[model samples]
Target: MLDHFENDMVVINDDANSDSVQTDDSSRLTTVENPTLITTTNHQVVKLQLNATSSSHTKCCVCRENLRDHAVKITFQDRDFIFLSRNIWIPEVARCCSGHLINNLLSKEAVDQNKPFSIRYQELSSSDVQLLLRKAQTLIEMARKDLVSMIQEILMMMNVVY
Candidate 1:
C-alpha cells in the first residue's frame, strides 16, 4: 500500500518495508530507492565502453566509401553471432554502410569481407553480461535440438522408430 503526500512523495504503508519516496523537483520524479537496486531500471540500460571510434566517421567499416546518409548501426544479434563464431568483437556503437547490412545484420558479402578494426577491450554492465550468456545458452540449446531431430529422422529412415 502507498500513501500520497502533498509534494507527490509516497510513503509505503507496510510493516515489513518502511520505504519513503523522494521527490525530485528538477526531474519531477518520485522514487522509492533500494540500495540493492542501484543499477536496476524499468528499462534495459546497458553501459558499454569500447576503445573504438564510433562517431563522426567519414568512411564506412565495410567499404572504403565516404558515408553521407545511408549508414546503419550493426544489430546486437549480428555482433553476438560474429563475436561468438569468429572471435572477432565489433563494438555495439559501430556503424557501416546500409548496403553492407540486411536487417541491421551484415550481409553475406559483408560478413566475408569486413574485418574488425583492431583488438580492443569492451566493457559491459552486469545485465548485459547476463543477456549475452543467456543468448549463448539459447543458441547452444537450439543447435542441440536440431542435432537431435536430425538424428531421429535418420533413425526413422533406417526403420528404427517405434
Candidate 2:
C-alpha cells in the first residue's frame, strides 16, 4: 500500500514481505536508469533530485571541460573560410573556474544587456580574412560587368530614332 503523506516522502506498506519502510528526510530513494524522479511538495517546499550519470558530463566546446548544473547558455560564432559565411551556435556551457566564459568570447554588449541566463555574441575569426578577400574579388567582377552593361545601354539609347 502506498500512503501519500504531507511530507516529502511516500510511505510504503509491503504486505508480501510485511516490512516497515522508514524513509527519512536525509536519505533519498530513486529508481534505476533515470535522473528525474517523482517529486512532491509539502509546506511550499518542493523536493526534487537529479541523478548524475556518466553521460551527464556535458563538455564545453571551447574549454573542453565538463559542465555542472549551474550553467549559462552562450552564443558562439564560427566563421568557415571556405564557405564565405559565418555560423552562430547557442549552447549551454559551464563557466570556467575563473568565473568567466572560455576565451572571453562573451561580448560587452551582452554583459550590458544584463541577461544572466543567456548571452549573445558574434566574433570574426582569423581564417575568415581569406573568405573576405574572395568576396571582394567576386564583388569587383560583378561591378565591372554592371558598368559595361550600363555603357552598352547608353550607346544603344543614343542610336535609337527620336
Candidate 3:
C-alpha cells in the first residue's frame, strides 16, 4: 500500500516479508474516477477513497469498530471557560463511542459542580485519523526492516548460506 503521508509505496506481504519501492505517481485516495480496491494478505480490504463530506463515517474513534447505541450529540466550545465564536459539531455517531469512556472521567472531576452534564466532546477530524494511520504505517515498515536485518545477522553469525 502507498504511504498515505509520502508518495512512496510500501507493500507488505506475509511470504515476501518486505517489498517496498518508490513510485512518483500512485493512486492515494479513491474518487469516482479512480476507485481501486487493494486487498492485503491479512484478508483486510483497503479501498483508496475520499472521505464522505456529507456526514461522518459510522466508525468509533477510540476503537475502529461499529459504534453502539446510546450516543448523544453535544456541542463543545473551545475556550478556557467562556464561549468562543468557533463551533465544533460532534456528531451523535462518534460521540457515543467516546461518551462511555469519558463519562466516569467527567464524574470524577465533579463536573456537575460547575455545570450539569459538562462532558466536553471534541470534534473528530479525518486528518487526525490520517496522521495516525501514517504513523502506524511508518512503524510497521521500520519493524519489518528490522526483522529482516535481524534474521540476516542471525544467519551470518551461524555461518549459514542463504
Candidate 4:
C-alpha cells in the first residue's frame, strides 16, 4: 500500500497523540488526473469543486465506507470553510455518511476527522476561484440582510418604548 505512494506521494497519517509524514522529494510530484478528486499541499488545496454531486461516488471520502442509499453531498460552504479553518480539503464531489453532516453541512467533528491522507501538488483553476468568490458574495449578502433586519427591529423597539 505504502510502496505505490512512496514514489510520487506524500502520505500523512495523524492520530490524536502523534503525526507522521513521509516523502522522498517534494520537488518531483505527479499530478492527480482525476478532475473530481480533492488533494492538498502544505499551503493550499487544489481542484475544489463548487457545485453538484458526482453520481460516481460510491464510498464516503472521509470514512471510505461503502455508502448506503442515504449518502449526501457535501456543501460548498462547508468544504471551503473546512479548508479555510482547518486546512482539510474536501473534494467538491465527495460524498459522506449522513451522520457526518448536520443539515447537509460538515460539522466541527466531521472537519476534525478529515485529514489529508495524501499530499499532491496544488493546482487551482480560474473557475474554482470564481466559484469561491461567488459563495463568499452570497454569504455577505445574507449577512447584510440579517444586520439590516436586526437594526430595524431595534429601532422599532426603541421608538415604541420611547
Candidate 5:
C-alpha cells in the first residue's frame, strides 16, 4: 500500500525484503545511490544495485519475482500540500504471480477490518428487495388468472345440459 509522510517523504512497503527508496514525487526522477548492505536474521543481505540509466527490466518489489510479461506499477502522490504539489516518484513493479497474493492479503485485511460487511450488506439487501417484489407480483398475477378461469368454467356449465 502507499503511505504518505511529512516533508514530502513517501514510504512504500512493497514486499517483505524490499528496501525503501527515496524519490522526488512530481517529476518521477530517481537518484540511485550506492546500495547499503545490512545483515538480516534469516537471509543474507545481497546488495542488488540498479544503475540509474537501465530500463525494461521487470521485477516484483515485494517477492522479487521475475516479471517478464505482466506487471503492476504503483505511483504514490504526496499527501501534504505544504511539502510539494506533485506526487511521489517511487515506481514499484510486481509480477503477475505474487501480485495476486498481495491483493488477496490486502483484501483480507480490509475484510478483517469490517470494511466488506457494510458493502456486502448494502448490495445483498438491494437485490433481495428486488427479488421479493418480483416474486410477489408473479404470485398475484397467477391468482388473478386462476379466478378468471374458474368463473368462465361456471358460466359454461350453467348454459349446458338443459
Candidate 6:
C-alpha cells in the first residue's frame, strides 16, 4: 500500500512539473525574440546636446518668434536612465522664455477693456518638472528593456543556458 501511495505521489509531482514547464513556455512565447536594439550613437548624442543648448533660440511656441532680447529666462531639468547599463542622462533646457504673459494679455483684452496693465509669466511648477523627469525615465527604461532582450537572445543563440 505504501509503495502504491509513493507511486501516485511521483505521478502527481511529474504532472505538476509538466504543467509548470508548459506555463513557462507559453509565457516565453508571448515575448518577442531579439527585439530591436536601442542605438545611442555618438552622432545622436551630439544632436541631442545641440538641441538642448539651442532650445533657447528656437521660436517660442506661443509667439512663433525668436526669443526677445532680455526675455525672462526659465530652465528645466530632464533626466534619463537605462536598466541594462549604468548610464544616467541629465539634460537641461536653459534660457527658455515663458508665454503666460501673452496669453494673459489676450484673455484680459477679451474680458475687461479697462483693466490695469499686468502680465503673468508661465513658470513650470514642480509637478510639471517632475513629469519631464518621469518621461526621461520612461525612455531610458524602454531602451534598457530592448538592450536586455537583445542580449538575452544573443546568449540563447549561442546555446548558453542560464
Candidate 1 residue runs with Cα over 4 Å from true position: 1-56, 152-162
Q: lDDT value for candidate 6?
A: 0.33
Specify the poorest-scoring 10-residue window by lDDT in model 2: 47-56
Judging by TM-score against the true structure, name the best candidate.
1
- lDDT preference between candidates 1 and 3, better one: 1
Clashing pairs in 2: none
Clashes of 4: 0
Residue-level lDDT of model 5, residues 1-162, one tens digit each, is: 222221222234445455545456463433333245322122112222211111124644333456655554432211111012221112222122234335433223211221110111111233333554565576668789999888888888898432
What is the lDDT of every predicted structure here?
0.62, 0.38, 0.36, 0.60, 0.34, 0.33
* Cα-lDDT of candidate 4: 0.60
lDDT of 1: 0.62
Q: What tens-digit string does per-residue lDDT give for candidate 6 at 38-139?
A: 221111111111111223355432233576764443322211221112222212342324442353232222122212122222234334445656776777
Q: List the residue pairs that clash in candidate 4.
A: none
Q: Return the TM-score for candidate 1, rounded to 2 decimals.
A: 0.53
Local error of candidate 4 at 102, Å? 1.3
Candidate order by TM-score, decreasing, is: 1, 4, 3, 6, 2, 5
**Pairs of residues clashing in candidate 6:** none
TM for every model, in the order presented, reads: 0.53, 0.24, 0.28, 0.44, 0.23, 0.27
Q: lDDT winner among the candidates?
A: 1
In terms of lDDT, which candidate is stronger, 3 or 6?
A: 3
> What tens digits encode model 4's per-residue C-alpha lDDT throughout 58-151?
9776677789988888886777776655556666677888898887777778777766655434456544556767766776788899998888
Model 2 spans > 4 angstroms off: 1-121, 160-162
lDDT (10s digit) by residue, model 1, range 1-162: 222222223333333353444655553344555433232222333444332433325677666567879878777787787666666676656777888977667888986666656646555555676788898898889999999999999999999973
The sequence of per-residue lDDT tens digits that candidate 3 reaches over residues 1-162 is 212323323343343433342233444422222123222221222333322111235543323346567433322221111111112223333332445336423222222222212234343244544554565576668789999999999999999975
What TM-score does prediction 3 earn?
0.28
Every candidate's CA RMSD: 10.2, 23.1, 17.9, 15.8, 27.1, 23.2
